[model samples]
Every structure is written in C-alpha cells, then in structure tokens.
Target: MDRTPSFLQQHKQTFQRVGAVLLAILVWQVLAMAVGHQLLVPSPLSVLERLAGIWLEAGFWSTVWFTFRKIVAGFLLGLALGLGLGSLAGRFPLFEILFRPWAVMVKSVPVASFIVICLIWMSSARLSIFISFLMVLPIVYTNVLQSIRSVDRQMLEAVQIFRLPWAKRVLYLWLPQMKPYLISACSVGLGISWKAGIAAEIIGIPSGSIGQMFYDAKVYFNTTDLFTWTIIVVVVSVLFEKGFLALLKWLYGRLEKL
Candidate 1:
C-alpha cells in the first residue's frame, strides 16, 4: 500500500493555504479602500469588527443553537430513513422498484418548490427541518445505494454460506464496506442540509434564526451585518462538516478494531 503524505508535506500545504487566504484578504482590503464606501464593499477589517460585535451578543449564540438544532435533527432523521430504505433497496428487488419513482422525484424536484409546498402545509418553525431533510434524503439514499451495490459479492456469498446471523453480517461485512460511502454522503449531505434549512428559514422567516438575522440585515440595508452573518454561516457550516466527518472516521476506526 502507498504511504500517506508526511507531516512536513502536510504542514507545507497548510502554510500555502494560509498564505493564499492572506493574499485574498489583502486584495479585498485594497479594493474596499479604492471604493471609498463601506456600502459597496466593506473592508475585511470592517467585517471582522462587525463579526466581533456579533460574536459577543447572546442573540448570536441563540440563533446558532436554534439553527444548529433544527439542521442536526433534520440531518439525523434523513440519515436514518435513507439508511433503512437504502439497505432494503439494496437487498431486495421489490423494495428498489417500489422506491425508485419516489427517489427519482426527490432527486429531480427543485428545492424551492419543496419549500413553497411545505410552507403551505407546515408551520414556519418546522420548515427548516423539513427542507433540510428533503435536501439530505436523496443524496444519502443514492450514495448508500451505490455503496451497497459496490459490496463484494464473493464476501456476501461467504457470509451466506457460513449462515451468519443478519446482525453479524451487517456488523462484520456490510458496515465496513459502506464506511467510505456513508462518510462521503454525510459530509455532502450535512452541508446540503444546512444550506437548504437556512434557505427555508429565510423564506419562512422563522423567528430567532440565523436566516431571520440575514433577512433582518437585508431589510435594514446593513451590508456589514449581512456579510458578518454570512461569514458566521460559512464558518459554522465548515466546522460542522469537519467535526462530523472526524467523528465518523473515529467511529469507523473503533468499529474496525472491534
């Protein structure tokens, strides 16, 4: 097997990334200075100042918690449903046939349409959960199904021949094979869930949400606030993605040791 990149190489790459980010910020500051108006393009420093102010506010944490809870709930629910359905579809032709049309529709439908329709049927407070679930479900389902299909037939046949219990088969064979796919799906799906959930919140104007803050910023023409809130969203989204994926990898490692 090929060896992983050395620590020195990884550190070099990290420094390069940091350098690139600094260069981009420098360019942004120069442009903002040339514009001579905060409205047009606020300097990076101004946005950072606004970020600091927002960071100190209790409402900021509340909004973060509110959105985080809803998004996580939706993501977990979608993951459970997708895994169950995908497993069934992978195992049985009948289940795959039954779910095919629905999966197709989900993958094809525009998120905006789902949000509008959901708004008519559900409360605004629940809109984020619904939208996030909808956005994540298809991706998880598809990725998991693909993973299932990719499982080694020889290994499966060996398990069958040995008459292993279903649970044993799943724990020993299925899960190990599906690790990469599940991880990939979660990484992509979590980001999608956050984006869709926030978009839904914006449209639904849910009280005390990050999306609502963005909406308020727009209403007041507070571009600095808008940029700051957007920065918060990006930071939170990236952090969540990284944290969740790391957890998943750790769990997989533990499972392998077992």
Candidate 2:
C-alpha cells in the first residue's frame, strides 16, 4: 500500500506559495527604499495602509459592486452560451461549421479593436460586460467541445450496449469526462474576463467603476492609491476564482451523487 503524506507534506504547496508572495513583497519594499521617492514607488507599507482605509472612501463599495456585477454577469452569460453552443457543435458537424467563422473572428480580433468598435455602438456602462463575455466565450466553447470530442469510444459503446438511461449516462460517463476540461476552461476564462472587463472600463472610463478608480489614480499620479487599488484588484480576482472553482467542484460532486 502507498504511504499517505504527512501534514507538512500535504500543506507544502500552500506554504511555498505564501513564502513566494512574502519574498516578492520584500523585494518591492527594497526597491521602493532604493528609489527614495514616494511618487516613483510607494513602499508596500504605505500601500497596505491605504488598503486598510480604502473601504471608508466615498463610493468604494458601490464602485466595487458596479464592476463586480457587470463582469460576473458577462462571465455567466458566456458560460451559458458556450456550453449550449459547444454541446450542439459537438453533436452536429453542421453546427460546428456554422459557428466556426464567428469563433475564429472573435479569437483573432484584438481586444482593443473590439473596444473601439463597441464604443461606436454602445455606451461605456455596458462595455465591460460585452468584453468579458467575448473573452470567455471562445475559451469555454473550445474546451467544452474538445472535451466532448475526446470522449472514449469504448466507454461510449459500453454505455450504448448497457442501454443506460440518459441521466445515468450523463452522471456516470459525460460528467466525469467533462469535469476537468470545464474546470480548466472556467479557471482560464475567469482570469481573462477580469482582465478584458477591466481594460474595457479603463478605456471607456465608466463612472463609479474600478477602472475609473485606476484612471483617477493615474491622472493624479498617486502611487500609493494606485498600488492599493492594484492589490485590491489582485485580491478580489484571486478570491473570486477560488470561490467559483470551489463552488463548481461542489456542484459536480452533488450531481455525481445524484
């Protein structure tokens, strides 16, 4: 029998990640000290101080919610459409051909180009949603379709031979096969969605958005505020990814049990 890992071994990866982040912060602090100019480089301490008090800033929560809701909405819309269309495409070659051109165009076009084009058609308030959706759609679609296509022929035949009900087939066969790919796609898609959505907000300068905060930080040349907001964005994005992936895994577990 294989030996189980010790507690330290089990948590080694987490400890390493924490150490890496601490080392990066130490380096940043050293760099700021060497620069000796607050405007040029605010120390990590100053950024943390700003972060501690940022919640009290006027419109802070509202601004965060404004960006958060739109970006999350876009991600959800993309997830739904990608799964629906990808499933159809996997089942029918004609559907694949039908969607191929649009997928190729979306994947090929630069995000900045899309932002410019979208600005011509829509207001800044909705820009982040569209960009986030566009960023996520192809990624999820490709992963889902590939997962479906990669299913084992022998396993599929066994299901057919057993005359398993549709629900059972999905629970026992499809879900297991698609789980890893879907998780991976969502992980990648979430990160891309945040990046694209934030970029859209910055360009469009949507009022009361995180992008607006960033733009203001840049315009005023407040390095501490800028660093503080950057840290907030990173923390929020990481938390969002972790929570979403955990939920997705939990959902999979519940479904598998059913």
Instruction: Indicate which candidate wins on lDDT.
Output: 2
lDDT of each: 0.90, 0.93
Question: Cα miss at 17, model 1 (Å)?
Answer: 0.7
lDDT comparing candidate 2 with the true structure: 0.93
Off by over 4 Å in 1: 1-10
What's the TM for model 2?
Answer: 0.92
lDDT of 2 by residue, 1-258 (tens): 879998889999999999999999999999999999999999999998999999998999998899999999999899989988998898898999999999999999999999989999999999999999999999989988998999999999999999999989878998789899899999999999999999999999999999999999999999898888878877888899999999999999998777
Clash pairs (backbone) in predicted model 2:
none
Q: Candidate 2: count the clashes.
A: 0
TM-score: model 1 vs. ground truth: 0.93
